[model samples]
Target: MHQPNYIILQCYGYEAVFLECAYALMSLSRLYKPEELTNTEIWVYTDKPEWFDRFADCPLPLHFRKMDAALIKQWRGDIDFVHRIKIELLLDFTETRTGNILYADTDMVFLQKLDDVWNGLAPGELYMHMQEGKISEKGNPLFRKLDTFLRSGKAIKTEGTPLYDLYMWNAGILGFHSSHRELLQKALEYTDSEHPKFPKHIIEQFAFSIQFGSKGNIKSALPYALHYWNMKELRQIIASFLQYFDGKPWADLVRYSSLLQPYILVTEKNMFLQNRSFTEKVLNKKWVPAMPNWELLEKQI
Candidate 1:
């Protein structure tokens, strides 16, 4: 019944979705006794504390920690600048827990209590979402590089080969016990390395997948978490959850003790950088809603 400390990394523009996921987790936490979740700490690692004011009225028990923008801006690597902050934050958690760490992404919504995963946690085994592709999966430039490396004698792919699966585990949800500092540190180093000249996409994720993949010590195929890629997929999952609760309302859904974890286990955050106008122009965007008309409310009347 060790208390679990869940860490969430976020910044401003995502305040809307971030608050949604946070409250969902808090609501889910009500299902278990406080002792069951010893020291349930929600570390909101952010670069902007002002955003805390927006969520100040939220019902979740949140602890805010700000990061120095100056320190992060100078970091070099293929990992997204924001992701680097997350990695660094993990280091902080490591010192406190020594090994017990459950990392989650802000975009995720939890559907079930994670006690199953926590109770099932192995001492030395790290839990990561299994990559849906082999190393040779097309559409990713990294695969091309791995292929070239394999052909160049730098890597060998034989039967039972470690590189055979070559799957890239999603970083959205990662669970690693303490005492794996060496591996985590190595991952950080590999990610920091600019050599081998890898592609810029999913850099940290690719490195982490390789580090864990080569060791062959990962806990795969667990029904612990799901990663939704975009708003469309996210909506579908939410719809399914809503249906599962017998078409319950969103606010009422919060009352279902069994529905909290799944609703809060979100892993992917949408970085809304694209201009809304650009997206609107690309598609006629004629997906009209069949719900209550809000246009009348915007009228001059």
Candidate 2:
């Protein structure tokens, strides 16, 4: 199985950020064999290598590439769009390396083994987490706003890509051959041109979507990885878990993380979408996406 090198672009700052990546990384330790990992490179870009000292023995051999404050600021580029760092990193990787590159966000957790996931991608294809839908059709309040803005013919400088029909793929997982580096540049250009006009946080995501769509074979990485972008409450849960798991070995962390499910995938999220009476649907709202509570989750662990 020929899996590409993986990149996790994160700077050391918040403890929740570290815990988010740490939990996601444990998914690797649990799924891949030691020998398989020996040949694979998991490049972790961060300012603090010591933050992950306890996870040193993980089967996924983490190679730390330090990023200082100035470098990170530069990567954010002139527009100061934070997500642009990912494109810059990909471009930087292609300058020196020739293999395939798989860039994942800190919020993602792998559901399949790395080799098995790699097997599913076609040669010369690109990937994002999954297709959310065309912006014109999406029911999301934010997408609705963007759709209205696009319909008014504001930024016609997007080089004739169908702004309304562009699908908003979640940018949590990106896989592409290193040779396709030019697309990243185009994505950056799209971002720079559109962001000043629209000023939404999702411009970078849509930019990558548009550029990669030009390749004609962008697959969904949803089956292999879960991007818990909507699970905002998880910060507290992860913090509690990190405190509980302090000083534990990598194997122990892997064991528990393997059992842990993304709260967004649980039944509570679905129950909210269930059919309801006209008045009840208008007046009554659900309190939560009820993941297993900490007490119950601890018992399960």
Best by lDDT: 2
Where does the lowest 10-residue lDDT sum fall in candidate 2?
Answer: 286-295
In angstroms, the error of model 1 at 292 is 9.0
Per-residue CA lDDT of model 2 for 131-194, tens digit only, reads 8889999669889988887777676545666687888888878888777789888888888878
Q: Model 2 segments beyond 4 Å from truth?
A: 1-4, 116-122, 157-161, 263-266, 269-301
Can you list the residue pairs that collide in candidate 2? none
Candidate 1 structure quality by residue, lDDT tens digits, 172-217 = 7677665565666766776665234443546567667776665666
lDDT of 1 at 132: 52
lDDT of each: 0.53, 0.75
Candidate 2 accuracy as lDDT: 0.75
For residue 176, model 1's alpha carbon misses the true position, in angstroms, by 0.8
CA shift of 211, model 2, Å: 0.9
Q: What is the lDDT of residue 292 in candidate 2?
A: 43
Q: Stretches of candidate 1 above 4 Å error?
A: 1-5, 8-27, 30-35, 53-61, 74-82, 137-146, 149-165, 194-196, 220-222, 232-301
RMSD of each: 8.5, 3.3
